[model samples]
Target: MAVARSRSSAGPVGYAVGDITSLDFPDGHFDGVRCERVLQHVREPDAAIKELIRVTRPRGRVCVIDTDWSSSVANGFDHLDEDIAEFFPEDNDPAAGRAIRSRMVRAGLRHTTALPVALRFTSLTDAGVVVPFFNCGAMQSRVRAELIERFFASVERSVDRGGLLFAFTMWIGLGQVPLGSMPRNVS
Candidate 1:
């Protein structure tokens, strides 16, 4: 409702809540489609990517932005990476960002390009939004309480020494639907 009200003063803007893997739009309905930070949470990211390409008209563009959580790094603490892996697990598709480009190409998009973007944070609180292990409260497990506290203590020590650093990479992929071509049902 807020978005609708906010855009009411501006020119026409459309918004619909729908499944990315099965978009309701007709084939070649949109001139451009863009999805951000969503594929990582999806079970079939490639299917969603194909759907994004499907809605775009011939010669139209498709853009996707997603995080490669496997590329996440925390410089201040030891064993932090292992702990994160144990907590989050690889089944989350931590490499989704790095894989979208190839997925788009395989789906028959032309002129596909992928760019890696490094996101750096000096504050643990800020990094917590993207990396939950950075947030102490978010890691409340009876078995791992001591380990979590120890990790935060190390982070604090690093901050005191001015050595704290957190970084992760996200990828932005762009592809163009070829002219005179219609997207096939890749499902």
Candidate 2:
């Protein structure tokens, strides 16, 4: 990858890595692209989606994945799970995950699908560590109750199913380029 990037960057400003909307490379450069958890953060997600499509070869493929907090499972939340909930409040909107599927197809891609996958690790004991990182919170509060409960439940379920761990869903979207449109600038 480094050698490829170096070859692509022939000058001081050659290796550009900033906005996805205006990629440094020319149109139809890459054969495959992966936009993971990136489109949602962009100010103009639609434009970003167009850029991803524009940069790839017409016959290539693009794989996009994001987390959908709205579709999060509640198999384990409860009053005792307050410690877990304090970190993950449902107040914040997860627009990126919710909007990416539709946006990918609208950008002119030929196909799109949402494949939800979950990972559960039971060996993790300090819910505090994982909660702060995943839930995006500090201490405990009613607002974070849901998050806490979910974490507890997920942990319990992980154990019941197997052992103590963390689990969350991942939404995957796939699209293909149009035939006969080979990329031009990317190696």
Q: How much is 40 displaced in model 1, in angstroms?
A: 1.7
Model 2 agreement with the true structure over 42-160: per-residue lDDT tens digits = 56667777777778888788888876544443333333245423323444334467666787777667877777776443443454454333333444433455555565566566557
**Model 1: per-residue Cα lDDT over 7-53, one tens digit each:** 68767777788999999999999999999988876888888988898
TM-score of each: 0.78, 0.57
Candidate of highest TM-score: 1
Worst 10 residues of 2 by lDDT: 84-93
lDDT of 1: 0.82
RMSD of each: 3.6, 8.1
Model 1 spans > 4 angstroms off: 1-10, 86-90, 129-153
